[model samples]
Target: MGFFKQVFKSVFKNIIDLSRPIFTFENNELKFKINSEYYYTFALNNYETKTRHDSYILEAYTINSDNLFVEYVHVDNDVTWNGLASSFFVNLFKEKLPINSMKIIEKKEFEHYEFITYKINDEFTLNFIYIYEINKDNFIIEKNAELYINLLQSFQKDYKYKFDKNQDLEFDINISIVKENALNGYFNLSN
Candidate 1:
């Protein structure tokens, strides 16, 4: 009877584990935190290339269908992040993208945080910021208070861009952030 009870408990535990979500999001001050069972998988799935080492993993993915790329780094040390970000910007200067206009509008570095803003075009802008010495446990916070504001103008527009057939054709379009990491790096789509 004891053996049967043990087996049942094991089966129940496995069932619960299988139902867990892959990724969860929590809002920070002005940014967001992405937590996942397989953070590496989540990073690799979105990026075109990856640089892995014992201390850190750096992955870069392109947005706007390969028109623009951003490199994100996951490291325990602050120095590693600073080095990677510097190298990335240096490379950007050497090899300019095919975009019509690209320029760095602002760059700032503080004791605990650093950020760079790039103006891609007249309509879009890209901002990258890193904060150090942050509390990893307090991942979520909420505060609501409205200040006096004025509405200048508001409008909504929709546009679609077509991609070439050979470029990223095998990518999964309906990938769920919560489900992808649960697969344990076994991506079904063929590349």
Candidate 2:
């Protein structure tokens, strides 16, 4: 009975592994290709910030070689400041995608959060933009202004995204602080 159980477990593990997508990174480009018609690539450029932090900017391009599909920028900061602002923007941009599937493709210790890329369709790919914040005495304050520009002549003007019922896609910027022993306060921009 024990021998049979071990055999079954090995077979199950192989099946699960075969169902996952394959990712590859070579020559400074990270790529995932499902077929000729479906794929995404990130062209990464890294530089040093004036403050001496390592920074990178990634441009996500589509299969047909549309260069300006989307852009993501990140600055390597301590873990405490890394993901706070990016999470908010990620939640906002995710609402714009059809989001067939999403997974974390890469994560680094010096990076703020896991690098997540979403598969919107065969031709569209999106990634998150990460910025940092400082927390002191269990309190943190952040201020940001975002300006979006459309550079494509073929951009859709009437496209709309339908979100899942359980998905919260609302964008209400606010301040939230969490301490080890207590909750600070939430300041909602809407109110």
Q: Which lDDT values do the candidates have, in the order given?
A: 0.30, 0.29
lDDT (Cα, 0-100) at 144 in candidate 2:
14
lDDT (10s digit) by residue, model 2, range 84-111: 4444444433444344445443222222
| Per-model TM against the reference | 0.27, 0.25
Report the Cα lDDT for candidate 1: 0.30
- Give a tens-digit lDDT track for model 1, residues 64-157: 1122232332333232222233434434433443446656655555433444455544434444443333211111100110000000000001
lDDT of 1 at 144: 10
| Candidate 2: segments with Cα more than 4 A from true spot | 1-84, 111-115, 121-125, 135-191
lDDT of model 2 at residue 165? 20
Q: What range of 10 consecutive residues in model 1 has the weakest lDDT sum?
A: 145-154
Q: Report the poorest 10 consecutive residues by lDDT, candidate 2.
A: 145-154
